[model samples]
Target: MPYDLPDDLAKLSLLDIAEAVAARRLPPVDQWHPGEVIDSKMRISADGTWYHEGSPIRRSAMIRAFSSLLMHDAADSRYYLVTPQCRQHIDVEDAPFLAVQMEHKDSALAFRLNTDEFVIAGPENPLRAEGDPDCPAIYLAVRHGCEARLNRSTWLELAHWALDRSDDLSVTSMGAHFSLQPK
Candidate 1:
């Protein structure tokens, strides 16, 4: 899906953004309890490109549909595309989604995923930094035990935004404080 980002995302109120997020309806993949699990022969590359068998899945609508059915099973440490009928395992190179864009407004940060989904960083969906301290990889909890890695540009944008907020390299959203420092 084509997403038209705001000319000035910072100008938008957090309430408006929250309302928009709430308005979106996603499938309940978590509630699906398929007895049979099978290989999907699909992979999501480190760059967030979806591939089936050996070829890339170019359809945005199809990717979007498949993504909505995505779930991470903690028991197996695996990702799957689930439905009421069956569960199909898929490989994720790094993360299921890539955070391509970010917006800071009202002390809250909103991220736009490669799949054109919006996620607000807060208590329910938190941000985490890992890997090297000098160039820490940042990620945001998406849903159903899945995460979205912040892309290079989005990370830089968030870093700049954080620098403007505090010297401690921390930011607060919905009364929860998040450290940008790598752990």
Candidate 2:
């Protein structure tokens, strides 16, 4: 079901947003009409730190709340904190979130995000790496165009699980083969 948000998102508190998400009342963010332009002071750094006006946002709850509203607008090639009635753009240096942990579950790999969301590595949510095995920018598609950059430890774990194929470093998840890197 669609959410009934305040006409002005600025008036909505973090708690409100969190509650809406927790209740699974998110509307299709891509379909939301943009209201008055609101410039966000927030920026997600390469290491998954959320900063507001150059200062790190230290509250974990606030970070999780904001993450619930994150959406990648393919049309604009930008990310936004989307609400039912209002939206605001945000900057993402690498990815909006981080995959901090991983679990090898039977035939699939389940990634746990910093937000505590679990994403199974499969055809719908693929794992990828940009660069060599030693120093790679690893990412896992968390949901709906939102990718989580795998933390260093998670990346290392993925590397250990990857199979060295004839011409690529690959892994099998849910019977689907994913290429990690060209050998």
Q: Which pairs in model 1 have colliding backbones? A: none
Off by over 4 Å in 2: 1-28, 132-134, 164-168
| C-alpha RMSD values across all candidates | 2.2, 9.3
How does residue 103 of candidate 1 score in lDDT? 86
lDDT of 2 by residue, 139-168 (tens): 788665889988989877777767432345
Best by TM-score: 1
TM-score of candidate 2 against the unseen true structure = 0.78
| Candidate 1 lDDT score relative to the true structure | 0.88
lDDT of 1 at 140: 94
Model 2 residue 56 distance off true place after TM-score fit, in angstroms: 1.4
Candidate 1 Cα misplacement greater than 4 A, ranges: 1-12
> What does the lDDT read for residue 1 in candidate 2?
40
